[model samples]
Target: MDGSEKPPRGSAAHRVEAALLEEIAAGGIAAGERLDETRLAERFGVSRTPIREALSRLAAQGVLESGEGRGMRVAQYSREELAQMFEAMHEIEALCARLASQRLTLLARSQIEVAQAECKAAAEAGDLPRYLRANEEFHLSIYRAIENPYIFEIAADFRRRTGPFRAKKFADAGDLVASAESHDDLLEKIFSANSNIAAEGMRQHMAASFLRVLAAN
Candidate 1:
């Protein structure tokens, strides 16, 4: 799950981080908007110490960066940077799909099925939030089915870093329906146990998504 979705537990810094991440993903804090420590501390009912720690964590995650003067700002992606990131993600995800097509267990396949169903229902109902949630699960199921913790972690981290940009696309119902339909294509390829086909299917899907994001910007 993305840090924002889960119930926050542990230290004050962790809670602050989760809240900030949610705000960033929801676009409440725009790209390149400066984050004041004092303002955030007051907003979250915490102190500067935890707020500082949370900001640092976000910076490390590529969600925030040091600004011109002092504090940090939400990181803005350049067109080239976004293109490059999506290219890498496409290859990584495609490989995962290939591996998953060959390796998925019965339970893993069932989980993917359920996630896809949720996505379809959400899209038909025009529920953006629900569609995004189910979409994450749909992708994660493929990552888990690959049976490689390292690959799963890499995929999860990329998803988290790009969460804000991806969230923007959810506002369009046409895009949401297209995404749900693509998931169906991916599942069909995976279920067929055709590694090459599955990889290509995933690559095509990722490429389409990259274009949508680029167009939106």
Candidate 2:
């Protein structure tokens, strides 16, 4: 789950899970990286049970697969598989953009604009970690504006699956700035109040992003 679909607030296992999700999304953890419960426990200052539980949840969600011994590794997909997943993500995000444009509110616009400002600022400052977090927030704000929980969950799941993959495309401040700037046109279309236009804009945006990821790969 992404930060948006957080598993309750205070469960130890969930805490570990959430933290790991952010680390993975931010590219701190590489694809197919192996994780051991004991190491995770020590890193998080928690008992092994919670580490086990967290890993189990990730496994259940297909984010991790069993590795050698008692370890688990991050799920990594072949290029063909990633392309297929990106195709689906393209459609879902377009739908989300459509709905968000149709059902936009003042608060949602404010939130998106604020998130984008932070994203641009972080990129300009060459602060990758902050930009990653802000990027996630920017999309989450858009997802929430659609006012559909099921769609939000679907979008969030896709984001989680592709986060690490997408993170690879940004290797430096210039790359991050380009990504942040790309959002400007999309936001304009999303705020245009024309659902078809918004959807098409998002489709184009996602197409460019997918191509970038492929190039990076």
Candidate 3:
């Protein structure tokens, strides 16, 4: 997918959750800010039940915190927690790149290439939103290339947790250019079917992201 397609109606809950998560990541909602269920329910045009479910799911995933009388708030990661999460994510995504390199079908590889092209175009045009979405699709394309549902799921979960930091990093021109170059290297390694190179490349790619986060704080 090119990242513009909407999720199926059957998966509306997931779509809602993703939208809310993106808002939080983009700083539309500040960290530690409590989310009112009724307000969100009205805003999203969904029932309180679904809003509650989505909030609880995010809380379980460590993207939100829920407790006595405070309701749900955007999660605030300590520096230590952020470091650990980024390291864990780097390791997992590195493995995914290795597996994807070895397992990618021609179709998957082509799809990733297309996403990369779109991301490059968006970046060059300074289209932040499009660039962000295409960037996400580019990585998801790699996860899909691995053809392992569990690996894809784990990578996505890690992404959700780190989305805010990632978005902020890419807002910098230098960081966006560096990220695009890393995508070029990653794609080349995958194309060559060099799993080790792909793994290392992916690790280095995420290392930059982690560094950016560290540099920010």
Q: Return the top candidate by TM-score.
A: 2
Q: Quote the positional error of residue 175 for candidate 1 in Å.
A: 2.0
Measured by C-alpha RMSD in angstroms, how accurate is candidate 1? 4.4
> Model 2, poorest ten-residue lDDT window?
1-10
In terms of lDDT, the best-performing candidate is 2
Candidate 1's error at 48, in angstroms? 3.3
The true-versus-predicted C-alpha distance at residue 23 of model 2, in Å, is 1.8
The per-residue C-alpha lDDT of model 2 at residue 36 equals: 76
As a TM-score, model 2 comes out at: 0.94
Q: What does candidate 2 score in Cα RMSD to the true structure? A: 2.9
Measured with C-alpha atoms, the lDDT of residue 76 in candidate 1 is: 85
* Per-residue lDDT of 122 in model 1: 92
- Ranked candidates, highest TM-score first: 2, 3, 1
For model 1, the stretches where C-alpha displacement exceeds 4 angstroms are 1-9, 18-30, 36-45
Angstrom error of the Cα, residue 43, model 1: value is 5.4
